[model samples]
Target: MTTAARQPIVNDDMHDIITHVNEGHVPELLHCVKAYTPVQDATHVQMTAVYEDGMELEVTAPAGLSRHFVAYAVPGPAHEAIRGTVGEAMKKLGVKPDSRVAHWCLTENRALTAHFRRLTVNLGEDERADWRPGYACRFDVPGHEHGRPYTLRRVSGTTAEVDVYCHDNTLGSQWAEGLQPGETVTARGDYQEVTPDFSAGPALLLGDETALPTIAALLEGWADEHPVRVLLEVGDAADQRYLDDVHLPAGAHVSWLPRTGGSGTALREVLDALETPPAAVWGALEVSAAKALRKHLRTEYPDADVRVTGYWRVNEKN
Candidate 1:
């Protein structure tokens, strides 16, 4: 037998594979190490080599350094077998591929308004969380690496709901377009509570379409109904119905502003002309608008609890 035929072929891409895993897919690599290996606190991991049967991993944890060989039961080329083996390992270990990722099936996907889609997903057996306003679900959609966040409007017994504005072709719109009954969706991490303490008293809540779910949620769960003045801006005039179902306090009022100009344009006028400042101000809108408004609130209404978040930027993809 010739010496050249003695060694097995690795498809001649071992170096590329190693670099990809070491740099690009480090998070998934760490997940596998923590889930399968004994080292739960692995701070860092590196793929040193890839072979036909398995790959060599160097792990750094609190207990010190150690080397591990992640073997593959399905015999194939190193590149082809890597993903399958890792998935199988996770399945065999009875764990998710990543702790932060949770799979949910869509039960309801329908239009809440002319430009909005309400998506209701079934919670997992282990998930029975208490209901709250402004809890958001960040979807791990395709094409968007970091994912996009949609505020949760309701979380009933075994199901959670979020309203998505689907006017544009961005990641949010993409998710809405593809949503259907029984379709699987990946929600990353836990529900982020974005609502400010409404117990502070009468307040002013302002936002664009993206903040409707949160604003509606806050109103729906009105703690004492002190009084709330809401100024909402929507891209489409037809979206005013988004808040029609929200029952408000007797002293509260909601103003639907036209999206004549850029984000925060319509709402900015209302903020500047406030004769008597409310006890608190909460807003979530475009970045430029949020920054200017946030600064204005702090400087003008120094005594009030001013909370403004730049939810999205101009021309934001996700």
Candidate 2:
């Protein structure tokens, strides 16, 4: 491989601090370096490295007491490269390929054995479902966030569908956009356990594009006697066409709000303009916006059962 000059992304102040601290234990730290890789998301790439033996270092300042930096080193040039390379290397070293990334507290170095043990234990108990199989049905829903899409899957029995929005701009949209038929993605918890009971009561469904598929599922499953109202925010008329093409239940009241500015802004406008129905309200959108609407519902209609979630954020990678 051709070696290019490695331009450090860290600033002068950061470099000085790292150098000053590393100088004291550079040889030992370098020896402990086991693997490294680059982690790439839609927005950015970050370097995550792991150290075998671990290192101890402290940071000092002119005005206050210094802080300590403790982490394992993964030996690679950049964050993305390190992530890829280290993932492969760890597998060869007999580390479980599905191990979660170690969390580094800014205090002291923790033992690798302990960290790996905890990770292994957690993986055993993790009940998250894989969504990669459903990626084939994923389709972009224009207007809310740039390059974002809605993912869909057919569930057995219950027409009631569940959609998850993780407002951080990382996996949800990226996965939706890149999803192909037969691809698989994992969800880290029991979805059925957390899904609220929607049977009985007037239903007001509010969500962005991400929630569209779920809303459709609910409508399909809902009894004709149940009065359901849907408030959806999309990117444009094209999105409306895509949604309209989906077969929804008969008599389901649907309203579309085109997101002209920010994702949350459109949601706020629609909520303010609409008449509050005496019913159970399911409001899901981007994380920050969902929080805002939940607050509004609490203050404006205290008696309503409001369910809100931040589906995704604009620029977040994960």
Candidate 3:
């Protein structure tokens, strides 16, 4: 287990890059630092937060403290074009990247249903053990440039599991379909506080299939006095039935909202019309839905604690 700590700036190139970035020459800096591909090794940093100026990451290649900014104006969304920065850094250090991105090999892969696969990875002896529950890891399969965030289902020892919802014409679906043991894939985790804070009171867990694993973690170790309700949107009857199999905490009630094509539109509508707001809300949904819900919740229940994120974006051209 790698102990995460804050180390003084050891990489000189990193300091130089930050120096140029401070001069408001981010585009110029990117032109010089851009890598043709993601630089992979036995370890890499996981992005934790994004902002207009730069992004924050949890460095695993050399595990360190919480999050720190790598100065540069993000060209687009937080997840877009991040590898180039990481790759440039690794390359300058003369580290022969092992895989263009830090990756974990599959230890176990099982089918939960037609559309969901339970994938597991052993973090190995070299990986960090300070991982918390309720967060997600972005996975990138070989030959796929874009990555998708999959919630960490469970972690035991050095192994962790994630439930991937596979749909046709998706990169994740293709990877899961042909998955085999010993094959390595990229996994990145961002900042999501797993330390339960029910200080606001009972929580309302909401979202689609992507939110299930995270919701389950939130229910664990919860006090019996705290009331929790889950409002989920799934594709069909089979998806709903699968949720029933998961053993949740006491007094946890799940309401299944079935959709025809497994879309977030229905769920978004319900959330928009929701009259009763909970003391706290946690959700992971599609990009549009997550943003809309967050805005509405903040506007309506300004005092209620909310932590909602867009687990993935839809209709992306690339």
Candidate 4:
């Protein structure tokens, strides 16, 4: 639970930083004093203190010595790189990152079905007491620049469970398949809620195998006030196990589409044949298919609230 006030500008860190800059970046400090402050006749400048929003400076002007502060272009309590485009987008928006990049050890690795493996990590008493429900985090994958995101399924005490389906040859799939007990994984920031509201009307959710975990998570917590239809396209029938334990509500139905022709073939056929347009649409699939399907949905159902994400692109590393 490190916060900006707690860890951003610690005394030891500040001392080291001040020493480094005073010794090396003196010219830059002088430039800052001249350009930023009202000290136009300043002769010499030295950095005195550093704050999260700005740096305090000791300016030597023609008149006398005075103190001034120069604000940082980007504020500190700065977060290092976060995984996934969602994190990048957050950074671009200047959203203060959640300081939760921590190590979680592999406690349990068991199979849920033919291709799905359930991984449980020990988050310890600190995390258990602080973790909020509906927060999903990204785990660091070895050799990958930005690791993949896994849906945090459930938490009991200090342990959290996440399911990884490994039927594909993706890097994340292999990484999950190779994980063993005692090994540690880095949990990146938790920014988004895995499940979104699809309780508006007769909503349509179309997803491929990659979206299985999120789809199941979404359905389990559904409001169940509206009619919902789920269409899942899987390369093999075994992937249906990804949703084996998901309980569908009274007005909810799931249809499994087999990949016969190619990606999105079955989904396209189904969408084209639908007589009544849905009020809302959500889909996660390969890049081209997701884009094309979004265009089709926008064209046909102009009034629908549609959201389609390119989970993965064809012929590209996952």
Per-model lDDT: 0.76, 0.44, 0.61, 0.70
Better of 1 and 3 by lDDT: 1
**lDDT: worst 10-residue window of model 1:** 3-12
TM-scores of all predicted structures: 0.66, 0.45, 0.64, 0.65
Clashes per candidate, residues 3 or more apart or on different chains: 0, 37, 5, 0
Which candidate ranks first by lDDT, i.e. highest? 1
Which residues of candidate 1, in runs, are more than 4 Å off? Answer: 1-98, 316-318
Question: What lDDT, from 0 to 1, does candidate 4 have?
Answer: 0.70
Q: Write the per-residue lDDT of candidate 1 for residues 130-151, one digit (tens) a residue.
A: 5455776578878878789877
Pairs that collide in candidate 4 are none
Candidate 2 stretches greater than 4 Å from native: 1-152, 156-190, 193-200, 316-318
Weakest lDDT window of 10 consecutive positions for candidate 4: 78-87
Segments in model 4 whose C-alpha atoms lie over 4 Å from true places: 1-99, 126-135, 193-197, 316-318
Residue-wise lDDT of candidate 2 within 27-143, one digit each (tens)?
222222332212111121111212222222222223333222223235443333334444554554456544322111111111222111000111122233343212322222333
Off by over 4 Å in 3: 1-103, 189-196, 221-224, 260-262, 272-276, 316-318
Error of 3 at 271 (Å): 3.9
